[model samples]
Target: MAEEKNSIHEELIDETVATETVEGEAVEASEIEGEETISLEEQLKIAEAQTKELEAKLEEAENRYYRIQADYENSRRRARLDLEASEKYRAQSLISNLLPAMDNFERALQMEVDGEQAASILQGMEMVYRGLLEALKNEGAEQIEAVGKEFDPNFHQAVMQVDVEGFDSNHVVEEFQKGYILKDRVIRPAMVKVNQ
Candidate 1:
């Protein structure tokens, strides 16, 4: 009966050892799975870092887009201003072409006359001269008067000089060709003789 009891005790000890071995194997497997989980976590962190980098690049791209848009808008504004300026100055060439006619009128008006028919022609020429002057004035044309004034190199060109008593030196004595201005800028300098 004692032998039977010892055999039963040994069987129970063997079964306990087998169960402990199985449990040890299961613990080792769990450790390997934990290592794999840690590697997966590292991969996820790398992906997150890449995503942040991409977001920063996108932000920079968006900033560049806004700058380009602003540049385009400024270019458009400048173009509009230039077009308006060109339109405003469109009549300058036409007015410049009519200056010779004005000179002819001045010469005709200065000619001597001795009859009623000549007087009538003179009156008609005066009317035409006044009309032409008015039209030029309306289009921003101005005349520079140099006679009896100080000779300024900016507005007057000295063609000849004469010694004159009782007149200030370097003063304009006669205007040869009248100077003209357009939009406050001198288009032609006055040709004049200066008193020496």
Candidate 2:
């Protein structure tokens, strides 16, 4: 009987120890789960902050790239304009130098021719002058009309004023030296007599 009782008591003590160990294990597992949840939340917050910072940096880089592209396009446009201007006025100096020679030719043609030979020579000179004028015209050189027109300081230079009965006041009476225009710009102004 004593032996049976002692076995029963030992069995109860074993059961109690097993229950306490199981409860301890359950509490430790719950604590570990709570820690994991807190760690996951912190990681998510850190990742969100990094994403926002990267997005901001990307936006700034894009803005800088667009500005550089716009600046390049403007510089290219300016260079093209400069090149066009230079090409348009390339022959200005040569045309200016030829003006005196053209004046001399005009003076030679104005002289009187008495004989048949003189007239023939004058006709040949006139033909040459006509050819020169045509060539200049083809190269975008144009003559400014002065006589019988309103006098304008932009195109006509008045060296003298005259009182002519037939002409109106402030009108050009005579052109002494011819003016020329190249393209849309005036190369030389006409020397003229203005009516008072």
Candidate 3:
């Protein structure tokens, strides 16, 4: 009877030891799972932060690109305008120089003819004057009409005021010097006598 009691006591001690070992292993596994979960959360947070930083950089780059494109378009437009302006006024200097020669031609044609030779010379002068006027017209130079028209300060310069039977008030009675326009811009104003 004592031997049976000792055997039962040994069996109880072994069972206790096995149960403790299983409990210890379960606790260790739970600790490992907790550490893995924490690590995954930290990794996820780091990845999200990096994504936000990259998105900010991309937006900044896009903004800079749009600004540069706008600047380029403005510059291109300005350059085109400058080129057009230069082209429009290209013949200004030559036309200005030729004005005196044109005046001389008109003076020559206005003289009286006393003989056949003088009449022939006048005819030749008229032809030359017509040719010069046609050439000037082709180059976008045009004469401003002054005589018999209302006096305008933009195109006509009043040299004197005159009382005339046929002319109305503020009308140009006579044009002393012809005005010229080049491409919608006035090169010279006509010298005129305005009727009061």
Candidate 4:
């Protein structure tokens, strides 16, 4: 009876120890699972931050591209305006050369007027001629100097050389036809008679 009682006590102690070991192992496994959850949360937060940073960089790149495109459009518009202005004034030099001929027409009309109606017609034609000249002059048209000035090959052409008593040599004696300049460049050289 005494040996049986001792054996029963030893078996109860072994069972208690086994139960304690199993509880300890379960607690350790729970702790490892908690650590793994925390690590996964940290990785998620890092990924979210990287996504935001990439979005910001993409927005900045898009803004720069739009600004460059706007600048190019503005440059193209300005070039077109400049080209239009050039086309409008393309024939300014040629029309300016015709001013002297118009003046001669006006003088002839004035000297040959016979009646009130005739004089009125001549005045109307002169007005038209003046309007045409004014329009050309406003667009970079200018007349070249010829008569009574020193002969310059840059602005004048000697159609005939004349021996004049009073004028110095190489002086412009007469302008047969007027010349014209445009924007400081001689478009048509003055046809003149130069002194010998």
Q: What TM-score would every model get versus the actual structure? A: 0.64, 0.66, 0.66, 0.47
Q: How far off is residue 105 in model 4, in Å?
A: 4.4
Minimum summed lDDT over a 10-residue window in model 3 is located at 28-37
For 14-113, candidate 4 gives per-residue lDDT tens digits of 4333322354553333234343323434544555566568779999999999999999999999999989867866876567566667658656655777
TM-score of 3: 0.66
Off by over 4 Å in 2: 1-64
For TM-score, candidate 1 versus 3, the one ahead is: 3
lDDT of 4: 0.72
lDDT of 1 by residue, 76-194 (tens): 99999999877766667887898889999999999999999999999999999999999988888889989999999999999999998777999999999999887766778899999
- Specify the poorest-scoring 10-residue window by lDDT in model 4: 28-37
Ranking by TM-score: 3, 2, 1, 4
lDDT of each: 0.80, 0.81, 0.82, 0.72
Candidate 3 per-residue C-alpha lDDT over 90-189 given as tens digits, one digit per residue, 9 for 90 to 100: 8878898999999999888889889999999899999999998998898899999999999999999999998999888999999999899998889999
Stretch of 10 with least lDDT, candidate 2: 28-37
Q: Residue 149 of model 3: what lDDT? A: 96
Clashes of 1: 0
Per-candidate RMSD, Å = 17.7, 17.8, 17.8, 19.1
Candidate 4 Cα errors over 4 Å, as ranges? 1-89, 92-111
Q: Write the per-residue lDDT of candidate 2 for residues 155-181, one digit (tens) a residue.
A: 999999999999999999999999998
Off by over 4 Å in 3: 1-64
